[model samples]
Target: MLVRLVYASRASRELSPQDLQDILRRSRDHNPAEGITGLLWYNDGVFIQVLEGGRDPVNARYKRIVMDNRHDAPILLTYQEISERRYAGWSMGQVNLHRLNPGLLLKYGETQKLDPYRMSGAMLTALFDELVSSGAIECA
Candidate 1:
């Protein structure tokens, strides 16, 4: 069965631009073969991502993510069987928070900041859907 998993984590330490690139590179290289597709959003020290694929592959990937030393306090935000992939076009698209409108953020969130911890998984999902529609996602 197909599943969609969303999670948020904090960086263990200050991440350099190269560090972020490495992560995306690895995901792009590795996900397609596993039938995975998703989007990654990073801002400040926080990371919020969506992974969609078969149950086993998605679960395995999340397990590895939880064990990765670069992340701290990883929190599973949402996981459920899905009828279709919302981000099938991207192996791992990236949300460009820099280009995001603050008004859009405020529409779903309490503040202009993107804080996954403070928002419900449904809220984040809706925001992501809007982002996709708005062409705010940068291709991986």
Candidate 2:
């Protein structure tokens, strides 16, 4: 089954431009080999990411992410098992930080601070469309 996890974290002020670049590079490199795919969005002081893939690989990646010293402990905002792959067209996808906004964030339930499971398919589609349009994430 394909699994999707949406998460957010507070970025540290110490994070430098080079550091962010490195993290993005590493994420791109890691995803494809592990059979993982997703988009990462950053704004304000938060890093929000959506990961989708096999259960084992996805879980393992999440473990590594939580242990990584670069990012703070991420809060798992939502999780869902989907019948289809939303980002199958991309390998190790990414979304740039500049494209993030309140509307985009709301797609992930930021405005209401609610769970994604409660969201409708239209809402999810809107969120995915925004990510695709942003053209933020790059494949390694």
Candidate 3:
């Protein structure tokens, strides 16, 4: 069975641009073989990501993420069986939230900033769909 898992976590330490790129690079290299695909968003020292794949792989990946020292307080936002992949075109895609319009953020969130901790899984998933439609996601 296929599953989609969404989670949010705060970086354990301050991260630089290179640090983010490294994470993306490693994911891109590692996910395809595992049949994983997802979108990742990072801003204000927090990360919001969606992982889609077979049940076992997805669950194993989530466990590793939870144990990774780079992340602190990782919270599982959503997990469910899915009929299809919403983001299958990329092994791992990145969203630059800094460039998004404030009005867009306010539409789904209480403020002009994205606080995945405060948003519902459904809302965050909707926002991610909008991001894909708006061409805000970058892929290797």
Per-residue C-alpha lDDT of model 2 across residues 38-99, encoded as one tens digit per residue: 87655455666778899998888888778866567577766788888777766556665454
lDDT of 1 by residue, 8-101 (tens): 9999999998999999999999999999999999889999999999999999999999999989999999999999999999999999877688
- Worst 10-residue lDDT window for candidate 3 reads 96-105
Global CA lDDT of candidate 3, please? 0.93
- Tell me which residue pairs clash in candidate 2: 94-137, 95-136, 95-137, 96-136
lDDT of prediction 2: 0.68
Model 1: runs farther than 4 Å from truth?
A: none
C-alpha TM-score for every candidate: 0.97, 0.72, 0.97
Q: lDDT for every model?
A: 0.93, 0.68, 0.93
Clashes of each: 0, 4, 0
Off by over 4 Å in 2: 97-126, 133-140
Q: For residues 26-116, could you state the per-residue lDDT of candidate 3 as single tens digits?
A: 9999999999999999988999999999999999999999999999999999999999999999899999665576777899999987899
lDDT of 2 at 88: 72
Question: What TM-score should be assigned to candidate 2?
Answer: 0.72
